[model samples]
Each structure stands twice: as structure tokens, then as C-alpha cells.
Target chain A: MRVSELVACTGVPLATVKYYLREGLLMPGEATSATQARYGEEHVRRLGLVKALAGAGLPIPRIRKVLQLIDHPDGSLFEVLGQAIGQLPPYLDIPADPGDYPRARAVLEKLGQIYDPRYVAVAQLERALEALEDAGIPMTEERLDAYGRHIRGIAEVDIGLMPTGSAEDAVRCAVLGTAIYEPVIAAMRRLAHQDIAQNFFQKTDEQDAS
Target chain B: MRVSELVACTGVPLATVKYYLREGLLMPGEATSATQARYGEEHVRRLGLVKALAGAGLPIPRIRKVLQLIDHPDGSLFEVLGQAIGQLPPYLDIPADPGDYPRARAVLEKLGQIYDPRYVAVAQLERALEALEDAGIPMTEERLDAYGRHIRGIAEVDIGLMPTGSAEDAVRCAVLGTAIYEPVIAAMRRLAHQDIAQNFFQKTDEQDAS
Candidate 1:
């Protein structure tokens, strides 16, 4: 397929495709002649993933990082998983030392999960815990464990969706699934809160009035 | 206390607090003299919530909407809850007709939850489901139910942290808790993914090799 065919097949605009090519987001095509190059089926698939990530509001550089993980799966499983999820949004500023978050470590330990201090999600979780605590709602290990247990259930679903294909396919599935399914999870949680409050909180108010 | 005392108590900068005042995100203090006004404990608390929301990367307009929800809880429970979560970040351009998302409604029905079509989260979940399906990962009713069930567990924890105080305090707790605890839930999901990938996926690979 020529570049024009790639654009037509993927429905990406011509100039945008050119921008991706220029930015090295899209892999170069095989040179067919002095004036033209040909894209392949793999290029079409990669372009779709890139389009999804960009549509999900990921910056180009982060999309590049995710592509790097998909393109190269030679890293250790844990390292690759960490690097992939580190691409998720809301990047935060962390302190120099991870030791500043003993509570986060304690919570992770309670869940029987061990992580390197420098793991991006660990640092993010630590900061989230701090914010919750500062607002006078301390996150207990019991609560954290409960949240983790339920989250593990959802993670199982996430992993279940991975295609049984090449390493690149698996990486692509995991990263895109994480990025995409998260809003679903968050939205579901909010809906659940609304349902619970309506049922429980309102009932409590009536009982108190009685 | 005066505005300066409120600043000292909350540790928010004078300029930022003044900005919140000018933006009407914080309530005005009672005028005590020609030169100054007296802020009460409520102002201090409201200032803290404003600061937290702003630091959480919410824009000023969204912050104001959240503050309005906190201030006025006289709306129907469903409406208020919908409005509050509607204030959450990453607001998307939802279609005018919620009926466009029959799949989202189906999943909601599967969970035994009913939401007004116009709810923001419903529209968001609809778009998310479309994205997942477009990626060739169709979200089945069973999967959405499973996700919702686990998310309900997390929501139970979220509602548990509500302070037993004024309606204003409860709203503040719910809104801020939702905002702040989301990152914790997200990070936990990622950490769980890494742990499961390490223990489960690797073992599966070794078994295949064997």
C-alpha cells in the first residue's frame, strides 16, 4: 500500500500522517521507487494504535514511549510492565527519595506486592495517599488491601483481554487496554457512588428523622 | 481571624487565596473594618478545598462548579451526585443524544443500575465502550458487570470516608475524595497488573515451555 492508501485505509488525514512519519511515530515504508514508498499491513495496525493513543489525549512523546515498549519487548516482564503503565496520564512531581512514603510501602506489603521504590505508580500512589491524608481521610492498609483486592479482580479482566499473538500484540493490548478501560472503571465507580448514596445515605436521613 | 490568619492557617499563598476570592471560589469574609475583612473557620476550610482542587489540576471553572455543588446540596440526590461527578476532570465532548450508546445502557442495565441518559459519566462510559470495541475488544455485559461489581466495592470504601458533619462537609469529602482517591485506585490497578503479569503470565509462559 502506498502512503495515500495507508491514509485512506486508516482514515488519518494526509498531513497528519506525514507529521507522524516526520516525528518517527510511523515506521518508514519500503522504498518502492525514487518518488514513492509502500506501507504494509503492519503499518496499518500500528497507525490504528497510534491513532487510539492520540485520541485518548496522550502527548506524542508518551505515545512514542508506549510504541517503544510495544516495538521492543526484550525487557524483563516486571520492567516492561512498569514502563508501559508509567505512560498513563497525570504525571506528577515526586520527591528525591521514595523512603518518604513508608505508608505506601506498608500498604503494598499488606497486599503481598513488592515494588522497587522508584516505580512510577508506587510514587504516584504515595502522593495520592498523602493528599487523602492531608484532607483528613487517612488510607488504612485494610482499606488499601480491600481496594487492591477488587482492583486485582479488574486487572484480571484487563489481562484476560490480551490477544494470544506476538509479543508486540500483547504489549499493545495491555497498554491500550489500560489507557482505554481506565475511564470505564472510573465512570463505573462514580455511578456506583451515586447509586449507593441514593440508597444508603437517603435511607439514613429518613431513619434519623423518624 | 482575618484573611492573613486564614492564609497562615492554610499555608496557601496570599495571591492565590486572593485569586480564589476574586474568582468567587471562596466565600467573601465579613467586613470588620475599612481596611480588612474577617474570615471565619468556614472560609479557612473552603480555602483548603479550593487549594486542593486547584492543585489536583482542575481548571478554575470546573473548580467553581464543584464549589457550587458543595455549597448547594438542595437538589435531588441523583441530580446533585450527577452534577458533582460531572465536575471531574478530562471532560469530553459528549454527543447530544445519549441514546447513541445502547451498549453503555446495556451494561448499566446488566449491573441493575439506571442512570438518566444525560448523565456525564454515562456519556463518558459510552465513548469508552466504543473505543474499546473499535480496538477489537468488545466489552461484554458480563465483563462490565464484573468491572462494576468490583468498582462497587471500591465505592463502598469511598463512601465510608465521608465525614459526619454538615451537608457541606459531606459534599466536600465526597468530591475531594473522588478526585484524590482516583489516582490511588488507578495506581493500585497498575501495580496489581505488574504483580499479576510477573506471577501469572510468567508462570504460564514457563508452563508452555515445559
Candidate 2:
């Protein structure tokens, strides 16, 4: 397919397709002529994946890293998953010493999860807990464990959704599933708050009116 | 307390605190002299909230909107909560016609939640579902409900944490809790994925070695 056909098939703009090519996000097409090239099925599929990752709110550089993982499977799904999590953004500034995040460590210990100090999410979790504490909303062990139990269920659903086709499929599923479904999950939590609050506060408003 | 004391107390730097004042994210301190001003405990509290929201990755505009809701309450908790949800970011590009988002509507309807078209989260949920569909990982009603159930539990925890002191306190808790705790929840989800994946995948690796 020509570039025009690729754009039509994928619904990506011509300029964006060009941008992806220049940024090395999309693979180059076959050289049909000096000024022309033909894209194949792989190009079309790759464009779709790129669009999905972008829509998942990943920056271009991180998307490129995820694509690198997908393109070359190290055959260790665990390592690939770690590398993918490391790519998720908002990497916080960690302290020079690991001992500063006692709240984060304590919560992880309470849950019996191994606290790999190098994992980006652990550091992020620690930072968030610190901010929450500073904001005067400390997370009790019970609260953190409650979140852990519920989130563990959600994670099982996440792992169940993993494709068994190939290592490539597994990596694609993990990366996309993690990034994309997060906002959906967060939105659901907000909506649930609205629902429960309406049931409680709205009813109180009505009762007061009566 | 002086501006420097406020900074020392809150740990927000002078320039950044001044920037917040300039941006109207923080209120002006009472002018005590031509060059100096006095801040109070309220300023200290507000700065903490601002830092928490910023740490939650909310931008200036959204944080300002949340502060407005907090600073002035009309005594309607439901209304304040609705306005708070409207400020969450990544408000997606919606279609011209509402009928295009059948998937989002269907999922909401199946869950028996009232679908207010004005709600921003609903639209974001629709866009995410559409992207997932386009990416060939369309959300089944079952999958969405699974997420909905778990998130609903988390939301119960959120509402349980609501401070009942003043309308201001409630708004502060709602906005700050929603924004700040989301990343923690997301990080926990990722951590749960790692834990569960280690259990399944790592055990498989060991078994193969054996």
C-alpha cells in the first residue's frame, strides 16, 4: 500500500505517519522507487499499535521503548514486564538513601510483598504515601491492605487477559493493558465515589429538605 | 508567620510559592509592610493541598479549579463532587453525536449506574473503550464489571476517608483524595501484577529448570 492507502486503512493522518517514520516509531516501507515506497501488512499493524500506545497516554520515547521490547523478545516475561513498568512515566526523584520511605516499606512488608528498592512503582508508591501523610491523610496498614486485596483481584483479571499466542503478544498485552486500562479503572473509582456519595449525601440533602 | 516561615513549614520553595501566588493557586498573604506579608495556618494547609495535587500530576488549571470548589462551598456535597470530577485531566475529544458511544453507554447501563452525559469521566471511559476496541482488546461487559466491582470497593474506602469537619474539609478530601490516591492505586495495581506474575511465571521458570 502507498502512504495514502496506509493512512486510509489506519485512519492516521498522513503527516503523523510521516512523523512516526521519521521518529523511527514505524518501520520504513519497501523501496518501490526513489521517491516512493510500498507499505505492507506489518506497517498497518504497527501503526495501529503505535496509535493505541499513544492513546494510552505514553510519551513518544516510552512508546519507542515498549516497541523495542515487543520487537525483540528476551524470552523472559518477568524481565520484560519489569522493563515495561520502568518505562511508565512520572518517575519521581528518590532520596539518596532508601531508608527515607518507611511508610512505603512498612506497607509492603505488611502485605508480605518483596520490596525491590529498584522497582519504580515502589518508589512512586512511597512518594505518594509520603505526600498523603504530609497532607494529613495517613494510610493505615488496614487501608493499604484493603487496597492490596482489591487490587490483587483486579490484577488477576489483568493477568487473565494476557494472550497466550506468542511472547510478542504477551508483551503487547501487558504493556497496553497496564497503560490503557488504568484510566478506565481510575474513572470507575471516581464514578463509584459519585454513586456512593449520592446515595449518602444526596439522601441527606433530601432528608434535610423534608 | 512570614512567607519564609510558611515556606519553611510547608517545604515549598520561595520561588515556587510565589509562583503559586502569582498563578492564584495560593492566596495572597496579608500585607504587613511594603515588602513583607503574613501567612497563617490556613496558608500552610492550602500549600500542602497544592503540593499533594501537584504530586498527583494535576496541572495548574485543574488544581486551581479544585481550590475554587474548596474555598467556596454552596453547602451541596453532591454538586461539589460533580464539579471536582469535571476537573480531572485528559478530557478526550468526543464525537459530534452522542450516539457514537454505544459501548460506553451499554457498559454503564449494564452496571445500572445513571449515565449523566455531562460527566467527563463517562466520555473518557467511552474514548478508552473505543481505543481498546480499535486495538483489538475490546472490553467485554464482564471484564468492565470485574474492574467496576474492584474499583467500587476502593471507592467505598475513599468515601469512608472523607473528613466531616466542614464543607471545605470534605471538598479538600474529595479532590485531594481523588487526585493523589489514584497514582497510589495504579502503582499498587502494577505491583500486584508483579507479585502475581512472579507467582505464576517465575514458578514456571523454576519448574522448567528443574
Number of the top-ranking candidate, with DockQ as the measure: 2
Instruction: Estimate every model's Cα lDDT from 0 to 1.
Output: 0.79, 0.81
- Tens digit of per-residue lDDT, candidate 1, span B2-47: 8788989998989998888899998889998887999998888888
Candidate 1: give the clashing pairs. Answer: none
Off by over 4 Å in 2: A32-36, A59-61, A92-101, A206-210, B18-37, B57-64, B92-100, B206-210
- Model 2 residue B79 distance off true place after TM-score fit, in angstroms: 0.5
Worst 10 residues of 2 chain B by lDDT: B89-98
Q: Candidate 2 at A128: error in angstroms?
A: 1.9
User: Candidates' TM-scores?
Assistant: 0.89, 0.89
lDDT of 1 by residue, A148-203 (tens): 88999998887776677777777677777877887888878877887787777668
The TM-score measured for candidate 2 stands at 0.89
Question: Model 2, residue B47: what's the lDDT?
Answer: 93
TM-score of 1: 0.89
Q: Residue by residue across A1-210, what tens digits does model 2's lDDT show? A: 999999999999999999999999999999999999999999998999899888776789998998898888565878887787677666676445667767777777787875456777778888778777877777876678679889989999989878877766787788778887887887777767877887888677788899
